[model samples]
Target: MVAGAPYPHELLPQLVEIFSEMSVCIGYNTSLDLGFLDRIGVPTEHLTVIDVMQRFVDYLNANGGTHRRASLSTCTKYFDYKWEGTAHNSLADAKATLYCYNMMKVIK
Candidate 1:
């Protein structure tokens, strides 16, 4: 996880460089995360972001599942994924997001 305060001057350049090289960034609530990054002075205009939460909800609703609002925990539970570590931890959340994405992809 990114420790320290947001938009540390020492980290901005490196973040910009890394983001420039990335084709797409994936997150649970990507728009919110991107807004945070933008507010923190990270250049996100060139980055394409995928919101796994939205996709997961859409998938569930389109299928037989009745999920009006799907949380990370709900999605993981529905997919039968055993979550390790604490909830709300960025690393664990990322892993869970990936798992949800993979499972949804298989359905598609």
Candidate 2:
């Protein structure tokens, strides 16, 4: 969580509003995150979700790398991204996911 950020449940209305304006949501394990958002009353029905983990695995398979599953850490390491923050921190993890996605796009 960021400094002075509201808790998920407390920010439901703002989250819904923000998500509604977005064309798509991209994240690692996006289904899980969307599910949690849905459970917390955030509306995500209109959003298309792009999961970086799935994209990474598909990229690997298509490029002759034999990876069955791709975690955030694995993808970041494969792309040689250095981690500067604690693992599992949401903001850091999100940054890593975006970096991995951009790398995949470059490779494609």
Candidate 3:
């Protein structure tokens, strides 16, 4: 794990390699999740992707919710918070994902 805000690539590959062995990959609504990993040279072909956004979006649709936005900024506004640090940095992104998941639960 990284100790500070920005994560170095050297510290990340091992963790990704381990998790990539799994048959399934899951993330909220972010295609950027796997996309980012792929850009960094991780093989994503072995993994089956599932977007949790669909599940949550379906929930909202069923409940007649009119909010059509799910981007990070919109999500932050609706949920009443934003992530604490660097945007594109992987470690910060990970924390944002956790915070976003919690926020989604609250708003939904």
For model 1, residues 31-53, the per-residue Cα lDDT tens digits are: 78888778768888887778888
Candidate 3: regions farther than 4 A off: 1-16, 21-28, 35-52, 65-69, 105-108
If both were scored by lDDT, which would come out higher, candidate 1 or candidate 3?
A: 1
Error of 2 at 22 (Å): 1.1
Off by over 4 Å in 2: 1-7, 64-68
lDDT of 1: 0.83
Q: Write the per-residue lDDT of candidate 3 for residues 1-108, one digit (tens) a residue.
A: 446646647757785767677887666565766778777777787887766565456656778876554554454455565667876566665666566666666666
Q: Tens digit of lDDT per residue, candidate 2, span 14-52?
A: 888898899889999888889998899888888888889
TM-scores, one per candidate: 0.82, 0.84, 0.50
**Candidate 1: deviation at residue 58, Å?**
0.8
Model-by-model lDDT, in order?
0.83, 0.87, 0.64
Task: Give the top-scoring candidate (TM-score).
Answer: 2
lDDT-best of 1 and 2? 2
Clash count per candidate: 0, 0, 0
Q: Identify the superior model by TM-score, candidate 2 or candidate 3.
A: 2
**Candidate 1 has which clashing residue pairs, if any?**
none
